[model samples]
Target: MDVTTIIGLFVGILSLVVGFLIEGGTLGSLLQETAAIIVFGGTIGAVIISFPLKTLKKVPFIIKYAFTASSSHSMTTVENMVELSNVSRRQGLLALETQQDMYEDDPFLSEGIRMIVDGVEGETIKDILNREIELYERRMLSIGKVFETAGGFAPTMGIIGTVMGLVHVLGSLDNPSALGPAIAVAFIATLYGVASANVIYLPIFNKIKARLDDDLMIKELQAEGLISIQYGENSTLLRNKLMAFIDDEVKSESEQVEDVNVNA
Candidate 1:
């Protein structure tokens, strides 16, 4: 599990509760079953209506992965790519088949190696890998859109719930003393709607987008590295080229060390 996602979500919820308490609000006042059902149920119904069942079926997996830790293994990938480049340069392209097991966990790298081992043209390899990246991103973005749709509908559902509550308040005007509390209870649906949209749904959507970018960068790097190996590029040159994909700070420090070695 990704602890940051858990921590961020916890902190967000706690902030709301703490802020409410600071404002002299009672916790019991926030626990309205009617408001919850109205806001959450309506929001869910809206999302279901907006998307197909096949798309909705992926929500559980999408939500699970949003909280899951994803590893880029960028440096390890570069190292393996460099090693494969050297192996191919010295022995032959067929030698990469023996090293394929090392990349079994990374389907992108493993598949790229397999294609090259089978003598797939470098251009063809690049095209196939790029196409896979495009399709994968499309699917992930579609899943992220589910949360986006929910976030968009939640506020409106809240307003609907609040209005329904207010209509009830209007019917109970005989008990004027209860008006203030009743109005407050009616607004709780609005709170649930707004809070869930901003704190939960939208944030998860953005998290999935951010993860997509990270995963794409790693995949692109693998694609480039694999293509270079297929073309029998020099291992040193390929390493230098791939190192550019690392973070700027790491790349700068590595360059400085290289300069010192050259001067020595």
Candidate 2:
């Protein structure tokens, strides 16, 4: 589903195969099940030992995220804030009480709405929202670090597999033909390690980081818009402020609407 992830995998494998072919190697030479088992098994075992069960369970989700574009809630946040601003202007801050269920479903929106509904001052709301954002960012970064660690260790495990293969080759050195196969097996570990690290693990880590950044940006916009609403700013002013989070085309459209209304 993630084109980038798919492309990255395809490119990495293609490059590896091309490089191998250029070096007078064939696919048959690299087909080593024992090497694969060693690299994959050892790396996974080490990862399990390093991380908690709950954290480990999140690996697949993290992998999925790596390939998929982030689900940006900026537009949703802006829409909700615009509605809340209208409600506040029409019926005072207490009017938002009935909409609490909708707000509660979205934690970022819910927290900001709660701050305003609770009569928190704008500055205090900013502080509270910022603190929450920081906490979430830290948690997200920690999750990214887990995949990074996996990427780092995968190659090392591959080397370990290579060493094991070399050991077998050394024992069979008396047979030259056997040495070639053994060496091939040993090198396959390195290939798996490099492929997994470059193609999968590292890319996932970067994707999570990017997604976290986008999520944080959306939360920040929500926080700022909520604070502006809490201070009884005009809907036009609040809308203008929130529009900064959107693209130039959207901003232009919004401004055009304002221009038309002014003429009317």
Candidate 3:
């Protein structure tokens, strides 16, 4: 779980609720089916119209990622790359075939190994990997745009809901008691719109952006690992290079262990 995502969401909601309570507002004041229909329904409708079906299917996964850390194995990936580099240097690139099973589950590792096995040139491999990364980035951005659009539209829809309620109240202005309830309802839409946009849609957009950045970093690590392996760098040297991507504490521990082993 991502602490930042959880804390951010919790704090946003708590602040809103506390502010409303301080203003003597009840929870029921913000509940309006008409407002919900306008904001949520319209937003969904617009999103469906804007994005492809394939992209829409990724919404659930995107939501999950909002609260979860990325699945990239930073330190483990570096270790694997170092191992592959060693193997390639000792027994030629073809030797990687024997260890394919070890990295089979990792698409980035598998792809690099497969390309080497197929005798593809380094430039060709880099081009192919870059293309794949670009495609993935585009798809993620498309998904992120959906949330961004929702954030943008929800407030507008709220205003529409408010105007609609005001029109109803204006028609019955002679009934002062009815007018009060109608005015309250009208304002509810605006509240809901602001709350949803800030707490839900905008946060989702930010989370998606963060996830995309992590993914880009993971891909960069993979690319560097593959290139190091192809160049047949010494395993220890390659490992040190990869360790640069890890946190300082972890890198220190691993370096100390390596130093001890070398001395032994």
Candidate 4:
């Protein structure tokens, strides 16, 4: 589980409640079941209409993954790519075929190595890998757009709910004593819509987009490593190239390990 995401959501909710209480509001004031149903139900319906059914089907997965850690293996990827370069330098491109299991878990890495072992030209390999990256990005953006659409519709839905409530309240304005409570109830729908959109839908949309960035960076690194190996670049040059994608602290640690291994 992603601790930061969980904590962030909890803090957002708590802060809202605390601020409401500080302003002389009661928790009961925010608990309008009819208003909630109107806001959320309408928002969901509008989102379903905005996107294709197949795309909406991915909403649960998108929400789950937004709070989940990415599966990139960045440091391990650098190590693996550097190792492949060393192996190719010592042997030849055909030698990569015997070590297929090293990249078996990642299709992008696996396919790149497969193409290299099959003697595909460097330019062709780069083209195919770049295309794969582009398609992957488009797919992720489509998913993120679902949440984006939801965020856009929520506040509007809130206003719609409030208007409906006011219609009913005005129709029954014969009792002046009930007017204050009725007006308060009428605005609850708007509060539900605005709050859920800002705190939930918008945040989830941004989170998913950020995850896509990390994923793209990892894939780009794999593509670079594969093309460099095809060129039969030496391990030292390959390591430096991949290190550009890593953190400075991690680079220092990797260099220290390499020095220790060489000295021993």
Model with the higher TM-score, candidate 3 or 4: 4
After superposition, the stretches of candidate 1 with alpha carbons farther than 4 Å from their true spots are 250-264
- Give lDDT tens digits, candidate 2, residues 127-223: 9899999998986676677778878888998999889889888888779977776687788899899888888788878878878888887888888
Tens digits of per-residue lDDT, candidate 3, 1-264, equal 888888988899989988988999888776678888887887788788888898899899888877788766677677667777878887899998988887677777688788987788888888888888898889788878888988888888788888988998899878997877789988788877878898989988988897888777778778877877776667887777776777788777867988999999
The full ranking of all candidates by lDDT, starting with the best, is: 1, 4, 3, 2
Q: Residue 147: error of model 3 in Å?
A: 0.8
Candidate 4 clashing pairs, residues 3+ apart or interchain: none
Q: What alpha-carbon RMSD in Å does predicted model 1 have with respect to the real structure?
A: 3.1
Over all chains combined, what TM-score does candidate 3 have? 0.87
User: How well is each residue in 57-92 modelled by candidate 1, as lDDT tens digits?
Assistant: 999999988998887656767777888898999999
In the range 41-81, model 4's lDDT, one tens digit per residue, is 99888988888989888878888888998876667787788
Q: For all candidates, what are the clash counts?
A: 0, 0, 0, 0
TM-score of each prediction: 0.93, 0.82, 0.87, 0.91
TM-score of 4: 0.91
